[model samples]
Target: MAAIPAPLSHTVAAIDAAYVAAARNGDSLGVSMSQVIHPCDRALFYQFRWCAAPEPATGQRQRIFETGNVYERRLLDMLRMIGCDVFEIDETTGKQFRVELAGGHIRGKMDAVATGLPEAPETPHVVETKSANDKSFKAIVKGPVRETKPEHHAQLQLYMHAEGLRRGLYLVVNKNTDEIHAERVEYDPAFCLAIIARIERIVALDAPPARLHDDPTKKGAVECMFCSARAVV
Candidate 1:
C-alpha cells in the first residue's frame, strides 16, 4: 500500500500562522489619504483619534495584500517593456513618491510615475494599480473609476494633485481571469480641494462627526457592518 499522505491541514495552518505573526498594527499618524475617503465621517474620526483598536489583519488578508503587490510589480514591468519611463522611487529621497497634507497628517504614497504612454508620450502621469476579484472587476469595468470605486479614484486624484500632474494611469487586474483594465483619470481640482478641506476640519475637531446612520441596518449604513469603531461609537 502507498504511504499515507501527510495532513495538508498542518501546512495550511503554518502558512496562516506565519502571516498572522508578521501583521503590524497601523500607527497614529493622522488620517491616511487612503482612508480619508470613507463615507462615514465619524468612523474616520474614530480611526484617526484611535478611539478603538482595529482588528489585526487576518492571515488571509495578508496573503491577499501580498498577491496584489506581486501583480503591481508585473504591471510596472509591462510598462517598462513597452518603453515607458517608469519611476518608482524619488531619486532625491530614495523612497516611493509620497504626498502629505494637513500638516503632514494626511499622507499617501504613489506606486509609480510614468511617461511615454502610447497615447501621451510627453506628459508624465501618476501610476496606480489594483487587483480585484471577478465581481469587483466587473463593476469597475462597467464605469469610470470615480463612479465605480470612489475610494480608489480619490487616491489617484490626491497623488496627481500633489505631483502637480494633470492625468493618472489607473490599472486594475482581474485576479480570477488575469485580465487588465486600464483608464486615464483626469485630476479633479475641486474634488481634491474639497477633500483636503474636510481633512483639515476633521483633524481639528474635538469630537467625532455624526454617524451616517443611527441604525447600522439602515440602507445607507452598509459600512457600519465591519467598522472597527462600531463597538465604541
Candidate 2:
C-alpha cells in the first residue's frame, strides 16, 4: 500500500466534514418506533419534541449509518433475486407503509411489508432488517431478542401489530464476516399496546422527562454517557 499525499487527504477530509454538517439538519415531525423502544425517556422526549438541544452526528457516525443502509439495499436485492417478493412501496399508493398513532404525532415509515418468502410463503411478513458488527451479531444469534436486544424486539412487534401482521422475519447481516442470521418474530399484541401507551404519555407531557440518570452533569454517570440528549457541548 502506498501512503497518500497530505494535500489529497486534507481535501477528502474537508468534503466529508461539509457533508456531515448538511446531513445533520433534518426536520422530524414526531416519535418514530426507533426512539420509542429505546431506554432513555428524556432522550426520546428531547428528540421527538425538539425541546432540549441535540448534538449532530460526526462524519464517522454519518458514514456508519449510510453503510448500514447500503447493506440493507444489497440484502433486499439478493432476496429478490432468490425469488422473494419484497414490497418496499405500496401497490396502490406507491409509498412505504405509513403508520400513524396519537393523531399523527407519533409515526413510522415501515421498512417493508414483504410477501412470498421461503419461510412464510403464504403470509406477508413485516421485514425488519439490520446490520451488526461481530460481537453484537454473536449475541443476537445466541438468545431471543428479549434478552439480547429488547428495543429492536419491541420495534418489530410494534410494526407487525400496526400492519395487522401476525408474523415477521428479523434479518441481521454481520459486517465483519458477511454472515446472515434470520429469526421469525411472532406478533404480540400486548407488547404493542404497552409501547403505544408509553408513547402517548411521553408526547403529552408539558416538559421533557427527567434525565436517564439523577445527575447527568457528573463525569461518570452511566446515563449521561449513553443518553443522546447529553450534547457534546
Candidate 3:
C-alpha cells in the first residue's frame, strides 16, 4: 500500500522550523559594516550586543532572502556575459572579498569586483547587487540612488573605500518586472571617513546611544516602527 502524505500545514510548519534552525545565530562579537549606516544609533547598538534575543526571519521572509540570493548569482553571470572581468572571490584569501575595521569590530563582505566595463574598461570597480520589489524598483528607476536609497549608496561607498577602488557598480533587479538597472557610483572619501569614525564611536560606547526618536509611530519614524529594540529603547 502507498504511504500517506503529510498535511499541507504540517509540511509548511516543518519547512519553517528548518529555516529557523538554519538561521544565523543572533550572537555577534562586533558591529557589522552592514549596520554602520543605520540611521538609528541605538538600534545598531542593540543589534551589536544582541540585547534582545534576535528573532529569526519568518519562513516567508527566509524564502524572500533566498530569492534575492538566486538573483545575485544571475546578476554575476550577466556581468561576465557582457565582457566584464568579474572576481567574486579573492585569490589572496580564497574567499569573498572581506573588509574589517575598528580592530575587527566592523566587518563586511562585498559581492564582487569587476573590470572591463564598456564605460571604463581600464578601471576596477566594486560591484554591489540588489533585488527590489515594485515600489522600491520604481523609486530606484526614477534616478539618483543617493536620494532614493541612501543606505544602498552608502554601502557601495563603504565597499569601494575598503577595496581601495574609486568606482562602484550598483546593479539592482526588479522582481516584479524582471528589469535590471545599473548605475556607476564614484567613491566619496569624506563620506567613508565620517562613517568609519561613526562606527568606531558606536563600537566603543558602553551603552546604547540616544534614540533617533521617542515615538515609533510618529511621522518620519518609519524605520523605528520596524526596529527590534523599539520597546527597550
**Cα lDDT of model 1 by residue, 164-218, tens digit:** 9999999898999999999999989999999999988888889878887799877
Number of the predicted model whose lDDT against the real structure is largest:
1
All-Cα superposition RMSD per candidate:
3.6, 4.0, 4.3
TM-score of 3: 0.89
TM-score of model number 1: 0.92
Question: In TM-score terms, which candidate is top?
Answer: 1
Candidate 2's residue-wise lDDT over 1-233, tens digit each? 89876565777788689768767544578787666776777777777867655556677778888899999877777778878888888777888778776666567767787778886788888988889999999999996876787877877888888788998888889999999988888999887887788888888888778766676767768767766657722
Candidate 3 lDDT over 17-95, as tens digits, reads 8887777753387776667788888887888777777766787878888999999989999999999899999899899
Listed per model in order, the count of residue pairs whose N, CA or C atoms clash below 3 Å is 0, 0, 0
Each model's lDDT comes to 0.88, 0.79, 0.85
Candidates, ranked, lDDT = 1, 3, 2
lDDT of 1 at 59: 82
lDDT of 1 at 40: 84
The TM-score-based order of candidates, best leading, equals 1, 3, 2
Question: Candidate 1: lDDT of 128?
Answer: 95
Candidate 1 achieves a global lDDT of: 0.88
| Full-model lDDT, candidate 2 | 0.79
